[model samples]
Target: MSSDDNAAHMKETKEGLHSDHHVDILHAEVLASSDLMNDAFDGENHEHSQGLWQSVKSHPWACLWAFIMCFTIVMESFDMFLNGNFVALPAFQRRYGVETADGKWEIETKWQSSLFQAGQCGAFVGVFLAGPVTNRLGYRWTTILALVMMNATIFISFFANSLTLLVIGQAFEGVPWGFFIANAPAYASEIVPLALRGACTATLQMSWSIGSIIVAAATYGYNKRDDEWSWRVPLALQWIFPTPLMILIFIAPESPWWLLRRGKKAQALRSIERLGSNSNAEGTQQTLAMMERTVEIEKKLGGEPSLLDLFKGVDRRRTIITCLMYASQNFAGNLIANQATYFFEQAGMTSEFAFQLNLINSCLQFVANALSWPLTAWFGRRTIYLWGTATNITLLMILGICASIPQTNSTNYAQACLGVIISFVFAGTLGPISYTIIAETSSVRLRALSTGVGRAAYYVAEIPMIYLASWMLNPTGGNIAGKCGYVWGGTAVVCFVSAYFFLPELKHRSYREADILFNRKVPARKFKSTVIDVRENE
Candidate 1:
């Protein structure tokens, strides 16, 4: 075919795959050009030989872009932590809390639930909205838009007069949180080479912990002030992440996969060049062909490549695994760990000491998140996830057992210490690795939609759990305090059991290998032993 004819034909194939999801394996241009197909397969093998260090060296710009995008997660985490910790601030209580029969000011169980879950509710909306918006504007503009929207939403939060206003502000703030949560890891997964994929995507969780740590320290520092500034300062700080991040995202390269789908192959090649810091012209074309090949495989697997496709064919299993990976995090006791400051005070510690312990707890969480990277590398995703959940279950049962003893400072301290430890354990395991699973499992065409759906499941499960948590922790409510560990422990048992039986190990597999395994319907337990046939002769 002439060059012009070939360009037109390639565009037609991409449009078929993207618009209709009906590209035929035999007729598609991927097979039409045997040399292109062979080069694409060769690129996949070269990518496999490259380790994490080499991948980083090969794609430094990709790593940097992923870092900046993940850094935007700091905004979400800071706001999320601030929402859960609000009641821990005496000044915040004075501003929003009601006077109690015992002469202490406290936020209501109902109001507390509303405040704490408000961001999540908005996040749920944001996750769904991102799909259509990203389809229209692509990932880069969607991120920039979300960051700008955050400034408008946080304004409502910083100047709120009533508890009702505060809830509304937080809900609005959550829309951007949802945007980042659903899209950042998806972006990271698409832009990086296979060797850098896990680390790049898992960086989302590390950024989350960094945000939590900063908020914890800030809330602790500002808690002593009796003025409204105590709460206002934290709310105001939300602006810092978006403005700089918005500017950075404005200049970042768009996801080449999205670019390719839109049939902007030239732009896609340029993007790969921008992302591939060390690749020569030939290397960049190989990467592009490799991406094109993966998209073609997905095209053959499912037509339409929409959210509904997430529940059909091989994708159904993938969607289930992705959703469970995320939902398990909530059910497996991090809820209590997240609300450590409130849980500590409810367990009978003084407010000042609770704040101190909360700071320390968040710091430990940051350290744990960092430690999980090496663990993910050595033990694989499934091992760390199952073992972490197992360890959390054991610790939670012991914590519940401790909560049962007559309420003493030693017992309360023990409970506080255990909450800290549980947070550390969870941060090290499920927290970061969940992103890796989401990145690896979903079909390439449906990655953003799948990520949004999976994370939406998290918000869905968490909404009811938040109400339950507020009821359990509120003095006017159940006031079960640390004993909630028993409740979460039961849920952790469910996570551990389900994970052992269902979650697959995708440790060193390239995206194509993952697709082949999932398409062949390999059992989760046998994933590690399944050998893929990579020969192009077929």
Candidate 2:
């Protein structure tokens, strides 16, 4: 048969797989593709090759949307770091005790640490509750709920008389925190077209760096203040930052994917039109066909797959690898570098030197992430993961050894600075790339459930991290640096093995294609070859 006939036959055969449950998959892809056509795919790219930088820079609205949605993610990062590090900032300053030179509250007390943990505890509950809520109520409501709750957390934090009250407020904040983190990227992914998805999603990471810098700046600015009010202002502003976002997103387009999943075809079409600029009708039609097929498949499969289903079949491997990947990423030790500036002081550096070290680390992460942008485009996903995981392992070992050394007041700050730089290098490549892997490799039938599970692992992973570090950092123990390094080094080893054995390259595969890959019945260790290797016949 001729190629045209072969193409038609393949299409026909694929169409047959669009049974009931398969419809959800088909619709989501179509909606995603349509959203991309309007928001991401460029028909013009077919005719002319555009330089990568030029292509990205020219897409202002896409960039703007990315920046906007990522702002909340960024705020969350800022809060996470600020909350994490606030414990280390001198309790006199962390609590509302001291006043600033300008007569503002500087910070005070050990209770603030608990208040910070309170936020995470709230986050745990919020994260758990967000899934069903989003499923029932939609991403918009979740976003709104989080924004309101975050604002309340900040405002209540200002008035919190005791740690108990602060925890209560953080609990409220955590609810939305969980909601926003869970749904924001999914919502953001739906808004952009496919070609731009990688770039846009990767850019969300930039927000974390931005948040780190902002919190650092805020903390630094308030450092001179002798009062409790200094840090509170910045913490309060976290909620304020998202009020506008909540308003804007509520008025913005709902996920066409979500609409299609809920069997709202007309609404889905209308949602796509609103997302596009009227030049996207052809793209819209293509997207609609893709979504319609996806919806049909889901319907045939008898509706949404249960959480248990995510653990069955090839999806089981995908689920396991995904968990490992996310777990590795979180455990890689950047959180310590990112938040524990005060620990540097305990590590033999002065407070000024410690802050400077953190400054260098954050800057390097920005630079590293920027460098990786083009590299990610030229390289495939699996290659990046392998290289990044390996590189990170090496850097982490170097950090572990450096941290194990005894530093004096006269120790070389420059060497310490080098450790900070390597930390960023690890984060720049490993940090963002791991998220990409987790998001890409999972089966669509289990994406949301898997994502939530991965995120929960992330938060839960913190318990051991905090416990070990706290024990090691005890003034009498002097093992903080050593223990921190050991934990990360171990994680690196796991990552290297996981990548070698289990990870499948997801480059260029559609969501449906991924499903086909999982169903191929290849052993987990051989996944990459059977599905993605695609070497010519021997």
Best by TM-score: 1
Report the C-alpha lDDT of model 1 over 207-276, residue by residue, as the tens digit. Answer: 8788888888888999899998888888887877888888899999999888876666667777888998
Measured against the true structure, the TM-scores of the candidates, in listed sequence, are 0.93, 0.80
- lDDT score, residue 34, model 2? 30
lDDT of each: 0.83, 0.60
lDDT of 1: 0.83
Model 1: ten consecutive residues of lowest lDDT: 18-27
RMSD in angstroms, all models? 4.2, 7.2
Which lDDT tens digits does candidate 2 get at residues 1-538?
Answer: 7768755754553344332223223344433333323322233222124444553544445445555765677766777767645554554344634554655342333343454555566666776676667767776777777787777667776686765776676666666666666665556555555444555566656777777777777776665566666557767767557778887777776676677777665566666666655435455545555545544444454457566766776667777876777667655666566545755655667665666666666666777767766666676666777787677667667656666577554343533654576567665677666666676666543455666666666667664554555455434334365335666767777777877777777654545445556666555445445544211111
